[model samples]
Target chain A: MKFGVVTFPGSNCDYDAYAAVRHILKEEVEFLWHKSEDLKGCDVVVLPGGFSYGDYLRAGAIARFSPIMNRVIKFASAGGMVIGICNGFQVLTESGLLPGALIRNTHLRFSCKFVNLKVENNATPYTSACRRGEIIRIPIAHGEGNYYNFVGDIKALEDSGRVVFRYVNSRGEAAIEANPNGSINNIAGIINEEGNVLGMMPHPERAVEDILGSADGLKVFESIRAACASLLNTVGGK
Target chain B: MNNDSKKAVVYVRLKDGVLDPQGITIQKALVQMGYKDFLSVRSGRFFELEIKADSADIDRKVDEICSKLLANPVIEKFEVEKK
Candidate 1:
């Protein structure tokens, strides 16, 4: 199970993502530079969080045009697993790999804190480890974390089960107070139509270690590993 | 020159109901300065463009820029006014 984490020029969480997969999960991990056009032999490609390209011309705007994005698009199209976290989520939406868009926080301020997320759908490979409606805590830090889609489009996402994660409170209840960045419907994460590509604003890697105060995030990575292992076994059997 | 007569104003703003993180930051600063009268503030981009194309074609070209480069229609609203 070789996992690859893409590192853009200003990416700050590539190491964190690598450590979570390689050291914590004890899975084979590699660094894929933003300019690299190869994704051979990689089971999962991660777009880690960071202020890529200094976020100069809007978050993920310039990074989406990078040469490597072509490869990422190809990988996703072929049913490959791809996860984008935080700023990485911004990039996915910018590249049209994901639907909707991340906007400035409704409060118009950068928010950095642990947020409770409700697993809306666990049927996909990314959230198979999580039970539907289960609440998990993850840290989110970003200026543009608010997510929006047309009302009709949002309805479609909900109907299609693409609306995966929603912000919640400590008591496991959804409310305005728990809506950290004012994302519509409190959406913290979503998946593409194929369910192979996921983009979320929270940082699961940051919560993977118990020493960091929580190990809840490990379930996310573990789930992916399990899914990939099963996939490999299925291919071998065939 | 006659060609410079075509002008347009481009108004780019974040979609309604979406958060304006940068605008919120600025509002906070203004509040600290004792300007408590402001209920809310939203920041946006404005461009005054003069093109060489005639009115008939300029609208289409400007629309392309708005959808492709000037503004991301996903989270932004853009308005064009002839000048």
Candidate 2:
């Protein structure tokens, strides 16, 4: 399956995302620039983490209006898979492809470190490779990773099983101490109502290899690959 | 003496019941340091502005800033106190 990673001007994680897909997962990966409107015939599109546009006007505010986002939104709406990591998640939220907004870290500082995340739900295409309640360690580097939505919207997300991950302690227990960025309900990641788009604060690309001290994040990519492959097979057969 | 001299203090804060992630993070750190007496914490932004516009105009300007730039109305509320 072909995987496409969008690169904005200041997107530093594009290479890492490409490396994880091309070298680690051994998938056909393409790097698409932010200005390009076309997704290059790829089934899965990834918005990797980084300080896009220097994060000048809010983390993902400026990047959301990029020309390529139009196509990305259409692609996602059409039931294609789209994943946004960190600032990518910010962009997705700003683009209205995902619910909620990313606010400044409650501590009002940039956080950079490894954090434990509990898989809240494994039914979505992004987390289907992992079992429910599994804990994975990933790195999160952001100044605005706190997620907030209306209480009613949050309840709907919880009811619909759209919450995919939550901050957790090393023991896999949910607690405020495990929350590095103060996301609501310790949310580390979430999916849209349609289940095709995912926006998460943690960077899976940085944790996909053993050399990175963890290969736990590989399952996220693997899950997307399997889901996209199944989708392609279904389309081909039809 | 300037007739239009006026000052306003703008207090921006997360709305009630909205999660203050940054504040929660700090509260946890403080607790780790054994400062357990703190019941809750919330962080906010404060801005003091001296403007020459009329009070009505100042109110409108403050609203513009709150809606467009200074504060995200989706999760925050801003109050302008005239001085």
DockQ of each: 0.49, 0.23
Worst 10 residues of 1 chain A by lDDT: A101-110
Best by DockQ: 1
CAPRI quality band, candidate 1: medium
TM-score of 1: 0.85
lDDT of 1 by residue, A44-144 (tens): 99999999999965799888888788899888999999999999999999888998988878776689988899998999888888998999888999989
Tens-digit lDDT string for candidate 2 (A112-203): 99999999999989998999999998888998998889889889998988889999998998798999877878999999988899999999
Q: What is the TM-score of chain A alone in each candidate?
A: 0.97, 0.97
Model 2 error, position B1 (Å): 26
- Candidate 1 achieves a global lDDT of 0.88
Model 2 misplaced regions, further than 4 Å: B1-73, B76-83
Query: All predictions: root-mean-square deviation over Cα?
Result: 3.9, 5.5
